[model samples]
Target: MVHIVVLGAGIGGIPMAYEMKDLLGPDDRITVVSNTDHFHFVPSNPWVAVGWRTRDDIMVPLAEPFARKGIAFKSVGCRRVLPQENALDLNDGSRLTYDYLVVATGPELAFDEIEGFAPQSNTISICHVDHAVEAAKRWEEFCRNPGPLIVGAVQGASCFGPAYEFAMIADADLRRRKIRHKVPITFVTSEPYIGHLGLGGVGDTKGLLESAMRERHIKWITNARTDRFEPNAVHATEIGDDGQEKAHHVVESRLTMMLPAFRGIRALQGVEGLVNPRGFVLADKHQRNPTHRNVFGIGVCIAIPPVEKTPVPVGVPKTGYMIETMVTATAHNIRALLDGKEPAEEPTWNALCLADFGDTGVAFVAMPQIPPRNVNWSSHGRWVHLAKVGFERYFLRKVRKGISEPVYERYALKLLGVKRVQEQTRETTNV
Candidate 1:
């Protein structure tokens, strides 16, 4: 029996485990290690921060799902990865050896990079369920004493969807509470334009996003780099089109929620040739560590270079569909390796994200996840909002029932109309 160890149990890790089990036989042993035992549907965290969703609504126990699949689950955090020995050192002073290892620990929130930016400061974050709950409390207090509000992403941050969603939700919440006029809401970002979204503009996204903000009366500061945060205001260095920097407005705000930049898992530090300087594991197209073939990585923890350098610098965004693609590829490759066959290379990931506006939503699908894509499509409508909600409901039910499906394949075929094209080609060639 082969021993396979998977680290972390977030959006990336859990699904990868299921895929691996499906490929490997029942006799193989699989273990999942994670710091937390609960998996939070992170996309809905913005709604939780605005009190639209509760902690319980977004969280699900991992033990039940893993148990249903007959996989071993460990709730201990990984302290170090001894890839040379194919062993993992746990925080509890225990070690486990494996034939194959998967690192899906995801990114860490580097809140300490900014001054006066402690988690319990005047600002808040919705990256986790606990943080969202705490932020919701502060939001409620701010509603009673209306003041300026700021929401945006810091420099080098790739996950921009949450920032947009949070800003819109806050705006909606303020209006519902009859305090929209009193609170001045500002959307600040490192992106050069309103809808760059870390992948540059996605087909008319700039105009559409700007229009949405205008309708909501939300002010914006683009090409801005956050320097520090005080209790009442945030200071940023704003760059102009001429490549000159000037002191921007230090807008006063009663509430602020900024998404900090991401970094690799701390456990991966000092692992020679395995991780890049930024701490993300360096993997080939198949998600296997180039230096250590037995070790693999997926999700935000994997290192992917920036498409191009922006004024503020930006990284690639790893959406749910992208992560699942990596997971699927890794699972198949691992199974092949165990069978003494050469593993197949995984394809590069594309990004598909749906940003929820208060009144509606914006949907985008980018091929190759960066610039120079074949199909970069996006649109905004209330139907997108309803579709997002429906997906969330369907996903939760599937997880509860311990069902595993390739979500990316379904979306890719749907969005690109690939099946329709294939059918048309078949008919034409036959005729």
Candidate 2:
């Protein structure tokens, strides 16, 4: 009997397990390993930080759900990976051997890279649900003493959407609290432009996001290199298109929230040829590591290069839809492998997102996420906000039942005309 192990029970792993179970033979076994027992909805983290959501709202216990689905769960976490031995050393000094492995462990927040950059420092974070809860507490205090605000992704940060969402959401929340005039907000980012989002600006994201910030009276500093943070100020340098420093600014604030750079978790670090310098798993189009064919990678743990070089580093975001596409392709490839066939599947890596503000939002679709794509579109509306809320509940239901690609997901995608995987490879052969 085949024993497949999935690492990390976040957005990617739980769904991956369900799809794997449905695709694999009945005799095969599936076990999920995570450091925590509850699965947190990462996308709603910005909302949680602003006091719109709580820890209970986004968390679902994993053990009970896995038991109901005939899957196994372990929360001891990983000490290190022994790829050659096909085994993992757990933090509790136990070991798990697997016939095949999927590395879906998400990125580690690099808070120490910059001095005074994390929650314990001069800033608050919303990257994780716990951090968001802390941010909410600090937010209440910040509201009482409203002042200038700085929000953005620091240099080497890939996930810029949440930074934008949090900034706008915080602005809206402040306005609702009748403290907008008292707090001056500044948007600073490593991306060369407002909506580059590490993919060279998806559709009209550049125009729409910049417009939204302007409308909110939020000033910005693009191509920014955040030097460090002080008690009440953020010091950074803005770079020009020619790769030179354009200006320097020292923005003062009562509260600051800046996204941190992402690196690989300690478990997968130092595995030669298996991961990049940043510790992201290296995989082929089929999501299988070239050095270790039995291993697969998905989500933020996978290595993706920058779309283009900028004055400061900016990595591409592995958004929800894109990660789902990766999960689908990995499932198909693993199933094919079990059938003694070569892997031939490749994910579309499409970028679909809803950047929610307090009461309005921006939605975008970039098919085949890289540049020169087939379909590219973006729009803004209050309906996007409602849709985002509905998505949270629908996704929670999926986790509770361990139902991947549920009927509603399929029918909804069909109704909206969204393709999940690459139907045709770039290769052309003459018949």
Candidate 3:
């Protein structure tokens, strides 16, 4: 009987376990090793930071669900991944061997990359549920005595959506409390523009997002490289297109939240031919590592290069849609290997995201998540906010029920329909 061990229990790991379980034989086993005992919906973290969502609202206990599905669960975490020996050194001082391994251990937050850039320091983060919980506490404190606010992503950060979402959501929250006028918001981002989003401005996102920020009176500094954060201030330099520092500014703020850069977890760092210098797993298109065929990667821990060069470093985002595709491809490919056949399935790698603004939201889809794609679309409306809320509930239910059915394909198909109909109408009218 084959044993498959999946490391991590976040958005990627939990789904990977369920999908693989469906494809494996009855005797074959699946065990999930996680650092945490519960699964939290990560995309809803911005709301958590703003106190719109609590810890219980988005979190699900994993033990019962996994047990019901006959999948072993462990929360002791991993100290190291012994790839050469096909084993893992558990934090509990035990060793677990596997016939196959899936490395879905989402990235470790690289807050130390910047001085005073973590929750314990000058800035707050919503990257983790725990951080979000703390940010919520700080949010209440900030509101009682609000001042200027700062929110954005630091340099080398790949996930830009949540930064934008949190900034807008905070704005919405302040306005509802009638304290928006007392606070000035500055969006500090490494992106070249408000909508660059590390994918080079998907379908007028630049215009749409800039307009949204203008409506909310949220000032932005693009191509900004933060140097340090002191109490009530952030030091940053604005970079020019010529790659020179155009200006240095010390922005005042009573509250700050910035999305930190991500890297592979410590356990996988510096493994020859397995990880890059930044500790991200190196995997082929089929999600299998070439150096270790039995190992696969399926989430933020995998290395994806920048979509394009910018004045400041900005990495491509692996949205939930993209990660789901990776999980599906990896699951099918592993099943193929178990059947004594070469793996053939490859992920589509498309991306779909709804960046809720607390009131209204922006939604976008990139057909391949890289440039030069077939479908690149973005839209903004209150409906996008409603859709995001619906999706959070739908996804949480999927996880709690141990449902392995793929969901993003339906969203992709719907977007495709809208895209084609719009194209045909434009052609018919010669507009």
Most accurate candidate by TM-score:
3
Q: Write the per-residue lDDT of candidate 3 for residues 1-431, one digit (tens) a residue.
A: 99999999988999899999999998999999998899999999999998999999999999999999999999999999999999999999999999999999999999888888889988888998999999999999999999999999989999999999999999999999999999999999999999999899888899999999999999999999999988799999999999999999999999999898899999999888889999999999899998998999999999988978899999999989899999999999999998899999999898888889999998887877898876788888998898888888988998899989876666543643555744765687685
What is the per-residue lDDT of model 1 for residues 67-154, given as tens digits with 9 covering 90 to 100? Answer: 9998899998999999998999998999999999999999988888888675587579988889999988887888888899999988
Clashes of 3: 0
Return the TM-score for candidate 3, rounded to 2 decimals.
0.96
Taking the tens digit of each residue's C-alpha lDDT, what string does model 2 give over 37-147? Answer: 999999999999989999999999999889988889999999998899999999999999999999999999999999899998899999999999999999999998889
Model 2, stretches more than 4 Å misplaced?
Answer: 406-431
For each candidate, C-alpha RMSD in Å?
2.5, 3.2, 2.3
Which residue runs does candidate 3 get wrong by more than 4 Å?
Answer: 411-431
**Who is ahead in lDDT, 1 or 3?**
3
Q: What is the lDDT of residue 386 in candidate 2?
A: 82
Clash pairs, model 1 backbone: none
List clash counts for every candidate, in order: 0, 0, 0
The lowest-lDDT stretch of 10 consecutive residues in candidate 3 is 410-419
